[model samples]
Target: MTAIDILGIDIAKNVFQLHGADRRGRPVFKRRVMRDQLLGVLSGIEPCTIAIEACTGAFCWARKFEELGHRVKIVSPQYVKPFVRGQKNDGNDAEAICTAVRQPHIPLVPKRTKEQQDIQALHRARQRLVNHRTATICQIRGLLLDRGIAFGKSITKARRMVPDILSDMNNELSEMARDAIAELWDLFCNLDRRIISFDKKIEAVFRASPTCQRIAKIKGVGPKTATAIVAAIGDGREFRDGRHLAAWLGLVPRQHSSGDKRVMLSISKRGSQHLRTLLVHGARAVVRTAPNKDDQMNVWVNDLRERRGFNRATVAVANKNARIIRAVLRTGEPYRAAI
Candidate 1:
């Protein structure tokens, strides 16, 4: 066997496809192996640079390969797509990964620790619960509206009206309808409890992580955003600079330029949607409250709001915050409020 320098594995639940190349990038071997025999096969081969797409179970496999003395690189699926040739299959995908890994400029996905995955899972759970709660509220409102009962947009208002409508027999609601609404109300409360529980868990994580604490010191960053950013990109080493971080979060404007003619559209809105949303929401809150403060950040925010309008200003602030967060993570320094 030629001395394999790079090996790419296209991983799946039950089967694995591998493509190997020599130091000169010539294909050495391509084969398929059962999941159970994967480790045994790799253990026999000389230790080499292994590349895999960053997907489910990728990190675990990367850690395993690293322990076996192989240098592992987890490449983003998008980055590997361009290298794939011919029909798409496990074998072709593996080959593409092998090719992508050898490219000097191809950005590799950072290997996440188990702790970071756990924190990310918690955030995902909380987001699901929140969506369920919103759906429940909308369902309740729609049910009441059918009976000619209307309430304010606020969830609290809808909740308050539910009890009143159930108690008053004067309304058009049937007993069965009342029972159904009551059940939904109960569900809403349960979701609230679960979301609160997730929040507490996130808070505990924030309390325990000094990195989270340092990031949270920024004006627009709270416990949730702080923990999430840390979990998503630890130490900010993957990014070249703060602007790159902002670009990763899709906060920067999208460009469609050719030659000297330049055109820019809205934000690219790529990358982590959850982090982008939290940062934008936090920025919105800061903008709403900035009028009352005289701090340097607030003054700048207010001026931007007046010049760019509120919505544009909000996104601008979010972009700024993302850069600040990246800087703080890279430097391991706490944020200092501008006077």
Candidate 2:
């Protein structure tokens, strides 16, 4: 018996509608299943390709479906939205998903493992705390500056200055406002400590992974970027080459073509914005100190800097670094400074 080639699912928090087709491309099944019953139902079905939109809980469900002896593929919602037929309902969406899945070059999102989810959670929490701390400090500085006391712009100096600024008895702050300030200050301290702990934890993981160490050796690759890349691309076999890796990170140019006249602009900035930011920032750091190093990469960076100022050069370097990362991860090759 031939196996099913395409199956579309419209997923929801409580209920799901599944649309399945037989191997000959004829509609064979259309049914609604409760969330709890979904796995049991899928488990009984023979191994077949499953298609879904990449949305909340989709990845987790994909993992579960894969465990149940089915192949799962997730497509970007934007691409699937066009196929949505009249009246936007679960059945229509599922049918759209089926249509989208059959496109020859449908881009499939990689399914993340449980470990990747955990590490990503840590990264998200750390980022939120860092943002909160920044906002808290800004509020403190603004309140103090209202009374003629201003903090230095540097975060390090601000950290130390906050205590002395708040402890001043001469300040006109009301007792209630002062207490609130104190509480905020304490919260900032706690956020800082927790951030540091997470930093250490991430570093420990980075150092322990041979793949992470290989990536870290490359210039401009830091703990967050390295770990994210490692987690996102567990095995490089998923990508054909470095360019594909860069494209996945949305490093390639955007395309707008009509009647043979085409234009390409800045990077698409479509996927993994955080990862892209990390790579670009790290590239800036490398560009700033390129003169101190003597290597082909250094020369290349310097040449780019001379031709296209530092900012664009940084982006170029970051793009290249992203490619290098893909190569190293895919081939298990250690990084080497260019000749």
Candidate 3:
């Protein structure tokens, strides 16, 4: 029997397909194993380099594989897709992963630690609650508009007006309509409470982590962005430099160039949308307040905004912030504000 030098696994909920190759890249075995038999089969094989596409549950499997004495590489699905032969299926994907792993200089995803996962989960839960709150507010506004009781777009304004609108006998609101509005108001209040609870939890996480605290010192990074950056990228050693970090976050412009001709488009927007949105929002806040401040960053932002317009300048600031964040994470240094 040939000794396997590399193994690729296409993981699914119930079934897993594997393709193993020898030192000379010759196929040693190709088979599908039930989820229950996965570890048992792998335990029988000698330690080898295992490659798997980074997806849902990929990190968990990576940790498990490492524990079994095999070095695991988590390749992004995009890189593996190029190596796929004909039609796509579990067998072809497993083969493509095997081929992609052997390619030189292909970047692999770092396995996230349990703590990082926990922090990210918290952020995701909070984001979901925020989305729900927005939907609830919109629903309330729509319902009020139907009855000709319009309130300002602001949620605070709506909250204040809701009680008066519900209780006032002057309005033509039906008893059933008033009751419905009251129930919706109660839901709105409940969502606000839940969101605040999540915010407190995130704040606690930021306070407890020294790295997050340091990150929060940067101009455009608040507790949420600070904790998010720390949770998303650990030490920031995975990338080549700060620019690479910005590019990874999709802050940099997309390129379409061939030969000497060059064309640049909007941002690639390839990575985490949540992180990019946070950074952009923070940058917009900085840009809005830049005119009143005399700091070096503010001056630069103001000049950029004047020359490139507000939207471009905001993105430029976000890109710069992303790079600064990378540098701070990489060097373990505190951010110094310029006078």
* lDDT for each candidate structure: 0.92, 0.85, 0.90
Candidate 1, run of 10 with poorest lDDT:
158-167
Over 93-140, each residue of candidate 1 has an lDDT whose tens digit, in order, gives 999999999999997777888999999999999999999999999999
lDDT of 1: 0.92
Model 1: residues with Cα > 4 Å off, grouped in runs? none
- Prediction 3 TM-score vs. true: 0.95
Model 1 scores a TM of 0.97
| Pairwise lDDT winner, candidates 1 and 3 | 1
Alpha-carbon TM-score of each model against the true structure? 0.97, 0.93, 0.95
Q: By the lDDT metric, which is better: model 2 or model 3?
A: 3
Ranking by lDDT: 1, 3, 2
Query: lDDT score, residue 178, model 2?
Result: 81
lDDT per residue as tens, model 2, 1-339: 345678899989999999887766667778899989998888878888999998889889998888888888888898899888899999989989988888877677777888877777778788889999999989877877776777787789988887887788787777887888889899889999999999988888788888888998999998888887877768666677888888888888889888889997878987888789889999999999998877888998999899989988988888899889988877887998768
How many Å off is the CA of 198 in candidate 1?
0.9
Model 2 shows how many backbone clashes? 0
